[model samples]
Target: MSNIASILNESEPAAKPAVEAGDAPAWNSTPTTIGFGSVGRMGSGAAAEPPKDADAAAAEPTKGDASAATNSKEDGPSATVPGSAAKIASGDIPVVINEEDMEGQIYSNAAWKDLGISDEIHRGLLSENYLRPSKIQARSLPLMLSDPPKNMVAQSQSGTGKTVAFLTATLSRVDFSKPEQPQALILAPTQELADQISRNIHSIGRFVKNLKVALAIPRKIARGENVNSCIVVGTPGTVLDLGRRKQLDCSQLKVLVLDEADNMLDLNGLGDQCLRVKLRIMPPDVIESVQVLLFSATFPPKVQQWIPRFAPNANTLTLKTKELTVRGISQMFVDCPNDDSRYDILCKLYGLMTIGQSVIFVRTRKSATEIQRRMTEDGHRVTVLHGDFDSTERLELLGQFRAGETKVLVTTNVLSRGIDVASVSMVINYDIPTKPGPQGDEPDAETYLHRIGRTGRFGRIGVSISFVFDQRSFDHLNAITTHFGIDLVKLPTNDWDEAEELVKQVIKKNSAQASYVPKVDDRQTEADDSKPEPAEAASQSTTSTKKEDDKPADVGW
Candidate 1:
């Protein structure tokens, strides 16, 4: 366990003050506050505060060699802003990009100039303090920015600058001369993600002349009004509605992006809506010239099989299964005596760790409401967000969280993907995420990855603790670990003092260990030489042989 106290006490660079509403540069018509919501602003559109290891003076080595330097900065109070890329751990972790002809190609860190980015876009990147391209950016930029545009299906772990990679491509493809003409479209599963994407585009493309971005989400675009912007970012349903109404002209669209492709393409997820937008909204003629790009952290085997048809003749860029779990986050699990005791354990965690801001993921809206109520009563600044909230309320709650008005957010899985707040240091799985299956219920490893991924952004230290009170929940968690080849350290709830010390030790040990190694133990390693694919694991039911130790009398808190 890394010393939570020490982690909290570490000094971090001073973050610039949050930019006021309507503070955006002259060229960008979208307000700076559009994506983050109307609440207490957290940070300016400037880049996120980089950790010491990601300092500008740090040297980036050639590809294929991993740098062992770890981020020494902590996600403190001032670091709660979003947008911009502090991704790839400053070249500390090496990323492997798998392509057809370029299988297992390693990419070295390169400057923005290397990509032949326009001077306007280059000035924008420099304004955001983005010095060099991340691994994904270095590899995918050329493929996306080729003479004749190319379609691409790209995957990298969360927080490795995927948003920035595609945004750069989208911006570069846009014809700025006709500012009101829609030239690019970026679709996300949720409005929150769409807003975040909008902010990033503004931050990175700040200097591009006549850059107008319109939010295709509800209330942003009036009924029957044309979506007259160079780039449109919105949810699939809203975007589809606009297109069907003939408000969003697609004849000139040069690029189409699915920010989180796995969820967008999943039959059980948002696949149908996304498919409609592709087939019905954009005519075949418009779809032909549009460069389709799909990007996400994790792409399941089933989704991967069908991605080519979605973006025909597209180049593929992916990481192996073993490299899915983020090396920056410390994964752990808590064994509780019963469901009732889980809340008590949850309350105690805030006192034990040095968390900047935390997110607790529950199974349902009722659970989220209950946790928020109980935590608020206990003197914690907490807020609850779930699907029950209307679009405006959801946006407001998220804005409050980003503004740091609420230190803890209790929510359902609606927020599990593509919401980035750099100051999120802790993520708690109040109830393990599970999807209903033919057998009964199966662990959703993809959701699990996205849930924890919220905390460990931009190579900063992050901690995830999953609570399991029964045999079934424990079994589901175990299945998830096996699926991802990750080892979750077990934390005893019987003794708070002992548990705290153990956490510190775990963090210390993991921080000291080399990067990119899955935390699988030796005993678990021999049992299965081959692991099931994500698609198979979602349907497979399995039990864990591990048993919990006897509970003891608790020491005084």
Candidate 2:
């Protein structure tokens, strides 16, 4: 075994290795680690002193007088431009760089000055105590701010400063003299994300004189008013309508960004609308000169194949399927008695862990409403938000959650992706996320990743507890765990006192280190061997994969 594989095997129960892609060579196997050691913390430059506050640490690192050697590699091997098969064979770069070496290659202990951003933008970053560029920002800013402006498809884990990276690119492309003209357009999959991007822009670009940003979500932009702002952020449908109506002129557009690009490009979702906006709305001249940027945390295989066509000749950065799971969050699951008893167990979770703010993800609006009502009656300040709420109401609900007015949020899939709240310390999968598959319904691994990703923001210690009350739910959770090659420590719902102490120990250990490695002995599920036949069999399966034939199958992505 390789050193990374050996390290992982020593730390947790051994999982089946991931299968390499069909066309790739032996050296291109899935990586077992992805820079878990340095996530969400400042490098050697700011190691002497800690961040003033969590919010300050969460801020995008575009400021501070720290020094590190600038990475001098140009836009040669790493940039995944079109027709580059020979480049990979020449040993210039691997499709997926080793996660250990990735930090040195991309982050490289760099300062913001290395990118040559404007003084005004630097001042805005300083106000927020941004000590240095993050991993994503360090890799992407140079390509985004290149003289001729290159197109890019960049994917990093959630809450790793993707918003700041793209926002900085958008701000740098704007011309203050053309304040009333639309110079840049940023499209998000949801209104909440667009609003969050707008807020970040105002926070990070506060020092840029005459910076005006307009939101194109419903009711925010009038029917006939021109979108007269240097930068525009909105949903695809709203932005397309304004573009077709000639209210949002794209003639002067230089940079076009699609946040959550994977979902935006999925045909079952918003892909048609996005394509129309790119091909039908924007004029051909603007299309030729406009720089296209796509950003997301998870890119499904189908979408990955189609992305190169959408953003042709673009530079690409992506992670292997094994690397998709965030290492910082400690994931566990609770074995509830039955479906009906999950509610009482859910209420008991808050007392089990030290949570700053928590989000509970249900599968439906009715469940969300019911949970909100029950939790409110139980004396918890809770908020329920989903697609059923109007745009304005949704924004207001999110605002309340971010301001700490509501310590607990019950929501459906609407808040799953790209919405960042730094204080969220825990996430409960009330109903494990699922989607329609050929076999009726299967575990939605991507949604599960995003839901838990809402916590663990910027490398903070976060915990996700999934509830499984029945055989079907247990199997679904098992499939998800196998898909990611992750071992979810089983939390016993029968004993609150024991569970609480176990949870406290997990959190304390997680907070002290960048990676989570659970011990097999301590993590084994407590099975009811006395139960008859299938129940006893199910319990045995959940405990451990000791038998040779019972190991998880290798997944090829």
Candidate 3:
């Protein structure tokens, strides 16, 4: 196992190995011993070792010094994974390139254990079976709960667990006993995400009781829904609707989260509405400020301009856990001379799926539907999903594909982020998303990351094939490579058959790091009322919850 895998296996909470596309090779497998030694032995147990490689240490992100709250035994328990004890006994440890880079090294299990979560909160976390906090959580948790939490801003790629970080911070500040008034207001960009977030809050605060988490959405109002829950997640229009009705009392709100603030402002004219909601509740005297949390997948000039209007004094916390969407996946781009040649290439790629798993991302809804019909008619077990599909149908289709029911799926951008299925061995950007606008509608590097990231996730290895049309497009591909600091290696493939064989050989050669993605059943149904809420939903819709414009230029962040 690589050092990353060994550390995960030793410290991660799951009892059985995670469901994987396949098993890792033995040579890359780790020896049983991890970072365990007697209390006084540095680099083992409780003792700290000096920095590892100097270069990597210098490369570490210089976020402010934020020690996780010194968690107690219950709050931050030692990992109980098998071999943890053996490692302590046999302490010849291997060090990372940046051990001092981990100085605040918040990924340690002790961080959460030391937080000293209340017995009730601890129980919730235990019931949910949370193994360890993501990097974002480790750093943000303590700071949110600090004596005087100055407002803060954090930027991390989506899926690094931004939601729970803020949720825990929000929950920690609330006096559960006195929540009759709004003590917290969470502003999400969409109705779907609002419901999703509400469900999570219910589970996390299950033991907290008396908390009235609520939902404000067009659906709720259109259907005349009543929400007694305190935490509210919804599109801006509906939230503002409730505020205008005086149904919401923001007077006591101590926390405000512009979940996806970038998207929040991208809403056609809704950004103004969101500001009004905040303005209505905030008192001018003494400048009564509420703790604010802002997260986004990409930070552009337009989005950054709106931050001050929402969180004027917030500190910024940037995270790079997902610097490369294909970090864990082997990637290559295939050059398809023309659209007609694509079908012939796909026919060959299909033969590979007969032996393994893969997905093909098309460019449009119409194309996805057409391909689904053609593939299905051609005797393929294929599923297609796009934005046009209703929520229920899309969810069902995803469930079906996730169960390993279908080997190949033809989808559009809907599959870009938030869905987790590590077994997928390949991703084909059937139609690469590029600047499609009349003059400048092409996608940027961030869009490229979301497209390819679907494959290599949760430490699993996968491959991405980007079909380039010309020298210009290949140059654009090169820019994507440079932007992420990843090597977009040229694959040895003159044809589709060769590319398919390449994937098989690659998977056999390099086993993915380790799989910690929760199983369908094992996935926490709700937040355990006992532990702090898991990082806020990565499904954040990224930060602000608004649908992207049909054209890429006006797309929501």
Candidate 4:
């Protein structure tokens, strides 16, 4: 066994290893350990040692601090400790850990046993191959599962374990004795996200006796049908209508979660409906009993300031703007000769690397359809999804992508956020994400972040390639890179052989450095006099030229 694996095995009881020796090679194959020691020691009566590496150390529980380590045990299982294993094992949440608390501390990820999670739930997680908590889950789960559930405003990079973190909390809070009583509510920005979360809840809570979860998206539930499931996941508008008609009970709701909260709260339509649902649940009598949790990868400055007002006095855990981008994602740009060449360049990408599943983001439904057709002609199993599709069709298309029946998904902004597909190894930004700006249209930094975040989930390596066809597109891409302080390497389109070599090198370097700070070229000018019109104008022209296209010009999520 590897040293790290042995350390992980130390916490398991002598008689029962987490997985048998025959299965260890596949189950514990990763070179490094992530919070496994803390999990192993939970019920085996073993002591966890300090981690040897920084990542493992960050996730390991604190050690050697006698006072901090014993504080929770002395006060019983419900007392909080600043930096101690006792706090984790007792199910007490640590509020904040300052520099002083770091002395001789382990400060690693929380183990499942430390959180006092039920064995059944643990079995479900294990069955799904979730051996340990991700960074976000380790920090947020304890606080979320505490005695008096505290409101949480958590921000982590995309592909990290935000969905699982919130779902774990939701499952833990439900009272299975009354399986028909709705005890938890989860709101997502789109119907796809809601459906995805619902499926995840059912999978994770499968072993929870009598557990029931209902989806409240449009057409999924019929009119006048009451939602008596223990957990309800849906979009804001549908959930609001259900509550208004008394089909969904709010009086017994214990936890309210907002997935992709930044987008949910920023959009006018979604924001209003979300507030209405919250108001219905926060009646004067039960105001203090309900817990609110907000989660997303990015929270703009404006949204950050407004979140506290939405979830008052909430405990916050956020990443700095520079850290918002996932380091594991290798970001690069393909310099195409012109608009016509972009198609050929895009097709060549598949040959350059081994991609498990890929998503191509275009600006309009027309482009999405065209790309789907071209890619299909090139022998790719593709699915096209956009706002033009009805809810049912959209669900079916996404289901195909999730099940790996379709290897390539061509879509607009609808699939940009809160959609988790474990096998997505590459994301192609066919057109940079943009929004209507005072100066025609401009790059959308947040959407760009969320778009690429669709890949590289759960510590897997991911690649994001943007095609820059003209000076305008190049400028927009530059703005996005500058806004996020990203080091986006440029790929040469003239030579396929050379481009493949460079891409491999870039990915390898990025894995080791975890920093992409390309040196700035002071001579680069922003003179757009010779550049083509903005992408939005190009999209409009495409729509007008292809008048036979049934999709609308503004068709997008």
The digit string of per-residue lDDT tens for model 1 on 421-465 reads 666777899988887688977888778888888866655567889
Greater-TM-score candidate between 1 and 3: 1
Question: Over 4 Å off in model 2, which ranges?
Answer: 1-97, 101-108, 505-557
For residue 31, model 2's alpha carbon misses the true position, in angstroms, by: 10
The models' CA-based lDDT, in order, is 0.62, 0.62, 0.49, 0.60
Q: After superposition, how far is residue 404 of candidate 2 from its true place, in Å?
A: 1.0
Candidate 2, residue 491: how far the Cα is off, in Å: 0.6
**What are the per-residue Cα lDDT tens digits for candidate 2 across 1-557?**
13323432333343222222442321122222211112222122221111122121211123221111122233543421211223222333223222333322223245677665788888877666565766667656765675556577776666666777888888998998999999999888777788877887898899999999999887788898998899998888889899899998888899999887867776556666777777767877886678899887766654654454456545545555455666768887776777888899988886643346788888877889999999889986678887677778988988888787877888877777744666667789999887767786677777888888887666566888998777667657655655555657667656779888877765555445423321100000001111111111000000010112112111111
Angstrom error of the Cα, residue 511, model 3: value is 9.1
On a 0 to 1 TM-score scale, where does candidate 3 land against the true structure? Answer: 0.65
Best by TM-score: 2
Report the lDDT tens digits of candidate 4 across residue range 1-557: 13322422342223222122442110110111112222212111122222111111122332211111111122422222222323433534334332121112112345666665778788777666666665566566765775556677776677667788788888888889999998899988777777778877777787889999899888788999999899998888788888888888888889999887876665322555666677654454444568889887766543543454466545555544445677777887776777888898888886533446778888887889998898789886678887778888978988788787877788877777744666676788999877667787888777888888877655556788988777567657655654555666556566778878866654454344323321100000010111111222110000010011111111000
Q: Model 4 lDDT vs. the true structure?
A: 0.60
Rank candidates, TM-score, best first: 2, 1, 4, 3
CA lDDT for candidate 2: 0.62
